[model samples]
Structure formats: C-alpha cells, structure tokens
Target: MCDGYVQCNIVALPEAYAADFARFCALNPKPCPIIGQSNPGETNVPLLGDFDIRTDCPKYQLFVDGSPTAELQDIRDYWQEDWVFFGLGCSFSFEDALLQAGIPLRHIEQDRNVAMYNTNIACQSAGPFSGNMVVSMRPLSVAHTIRSIQICSRFPAVHGAPIHFGNPKDIGIDDINKPDYGDKVEIREGEIPVFWACGVTPQQALRAAKIPCAITHAPGHMLVTDLRNAELATL
Candidate 1:
C-alpha cells in the first residue's frame, strides 16, 4: 500500500518481554520510534487503524531464540494470550514525502526495495536489546539530498532526515552495490547514497537478545495504517 497514508513495521512479543522491548525503542528512537502499541492479547491498535495485527501486514518473520525460523503470510497460529504488539514508524512515510517533493528514489525507479545495511554505530542498550544500528539507503543528487533532509526533518516519528550521506565506508558498508538487506539500486555518477535510520534495527536487537519467540514484519512489507503521512509531521 504505497498510497498517501503511512505504513509501519510490526514487532510482537510476549508481555513478559514487552517492557524491555519498549525501553529498547525509547532508548533508540531514531531507528525504533514507536507510533502505537496493543495491549497484551489484543490484536487491535486503535490509534493506527481498525485492523487485526495477526493478518494486516503483507508478510511476517518468525524468530525462535534469536534466529529467523520462518516467513509467513499470517501469524494467527502463533498468537498467544500474552502477546503485545508494537507498531513502529517506518522509513516508508518519509520516502513518500521525498517522492512527493520530486526527489528521485532510485530503488522505486528501479522497481526494487530500498537498500539497507547494518551500521557499525551502536544503539543505546536496554535490557536484552542491543545491537548495531541499521540504515536504509537512497541515491540522490546533492541538491535533492538537501531538499530531502529538509522535507524529512518534519517527520521525526518516521526516522526524520539522513543520518549519513556520501561515504558508505565510513559507516562500515564496504560496497555501494552490496547491501545487507533489500536490493541494491544504482548510484549514478553525480548521486550519493543517503542513509536513514531503519526499523530493521529492532530485528538486529532481536538477534542479539535471542528471545524464545518473537514476530516482526518482513523487510519492506509494512502494515498499512489509516493514519496519513502528513499526520506524523511536526512542522
């Protein structure tokens, strides 16, 4: 649903670990900004939309003891009474804004997902959650890059602004053409890779935490919420 509304990354876990996960997002707001959450055993996030968390998103990744075990279309079978769901603001919101402003997104133009990489930058630890930050990249000309920064800065909930631009090596990314997640889009002669804090940061933390069971949105397949992208902007 690449429409005018914003989409979100989903993280669902047992209520026992919910506080730790909440703290993780609080400590690292850049990458894990929480927009809404559901109470234990509840599948609805009224603040986002009238929908069931179990089947709203296009796809989900199931993790067992920190390892991704399966990818599924619906997670109804795995739902538990103690499950708490977190709806996180995703880069898709700001990407929509960038596209509206006429800033070219190579990934979209190339019919591919935005390139993402695990960064050497460490996130503030909170209980069982701690890992290197992950970022999504888009290639843009210098002029468009500046405009994108200005445009994105208004949406802090959805990872506002580029955290890094130009050198991929500075952020521990060895190859511009190779990404740790998502497909690689071409960076043209006058274009540079602009990186934004990505929602995948929590998945990295999940890997480190190794919780017994957890569910997260599959990369790039976000929950389409009724909330408009404009509603998330501060200015």
Candidate 2:
C-alpha cells in the first residue's frame, strides 16, 4: 500500500493481438516492461496479487475505431472474454527512487503532471501496433540531470534510461514551454529539460495501429500495484 510502490500502465486488448503487443513491449523493454500479465478471460494479475484488472486502475481509456471514445471510472462493463491484460511499469515508479536519491522532480515540486511530448522517433512496430515514442520531461540543473539519468539507469524495468536530453528541437518539439501532453513547469535560471521514455508510449502506438478496440490506463491515473520501488532496481 505504499504510495511509492510501482504504478503500472495497463493495456487489456482482444487476445487476437495481445501477444503481438506483448512482443512489442518485449522488443522495446526500456519503454514497456512486462511486470504482470493475464491469460484470456482472466481478470487477475498474479504478479500484482489479489488484483482486479477491471477496476484496480485509477482510470481507463476506451478506444473505438482507433480513437479515444470516452474516459471510464471503471471498465468492468467493457471486459470481454477475448481480452488479455499487459502491465507495463510506469515512470511514477521511478520518481520515488529519484526523490530518494535527492534528485528533485520539477513537476512534482510544482504539483503538476509531468510534461509529455509525442516524439518524431518511431517505435519498433508489431502487428497492428506502431507509433511515435512519447516522452516525459523534467527541467533540472546540469549536475542533477546526469544524476537522474544515472539513478534511472538502474531500473531498466521502468524505462531504464533517458532517451535524450538538452535540445528539444532535436526530438521535433517546437517549444520547450509547450508540451503535447501534461503541464509545463518553470525551467529556472540554471535548469535544462530532461526527458524520459514514458508509459504513454503505448497509447501512441495504439493510435497508430488504429485497433478497432483497445483499453488503456489514463495518464497520471496509473494502476497502483503491490511491487515496491526497491524491488525493481538493478545494478
């Protein structure tokens, strides 16, 4: 029940393509770590334990015709027998680890959602799943920026390392102050923007695939899980 525990980003899709998506995550483990999974018609994620896949998550996205249809408080009504669940580690899971290491997160300090941008960098495609990578940004001093990358590198299961730093234009971002998703935070006199592989990467992929139907956890309202932050660390 620790707030610092890992919070996952879930994708419960029709079993016909679940395996393909899983393969996509496997191929790109940095952005999508498989922490828990479920077979067809099963609702529980044993790795997360005693979990109810339909409602344990804070919020959900319903996609119809490859576009977001509506937000749901809970998705029990849409649960299908042909569905399977895939749990990917969230960026929030590593924020606690970062804070513990004395790396202050600008968004958390400002009480805002992390800045996310849809990058021009395309992801490795799988059957019906291909899209640009989405990234989260935080502004910090140069020294702290390196430290954050070093600490995050230990948790490859949760977006192990930052994809890029410094120039936003290199990633196709036109403005450092304007983001495609989430809120922007002040850059301060000495801080530079740092980016990370975000959990929202899957959402970008889903949109590209244009799946007839897909379900995903909404931004910020991640699926809280039983895994502790320390448990996800690697040397």
* Inter-residue clash pairs, candidate 1: none
C-alpha TM-scores of all predictions: 0.97, 0.96
- Residue-level lDDT tens digits of model 1 in 8-88: 999999999999999999999999999998999999989999999999889999999999999989999999999999999
Lowest-scoring 10 consecutive residues by lDDT in candidate 1? 101-110
Using TM-score, give the best candidate's number: 1
Where model 1 places Cα greater than 4 Å from the true spot, the runs are none
Residue 178 of model 1, lDDT score? 83
lDDT of 2 by residue, 1-235 (tens): 3576888889989998898999889877777788888989899877886788898888899988688989999998999998999988888878888899889887898889899998888788888888888899988889998898899999988997788998998998888788889997788888888889888888877888787888998767778887888888987
Model 1: C-alpha RMSD to truth?
1.1
Error of 1 at 114 (Å): 0.8
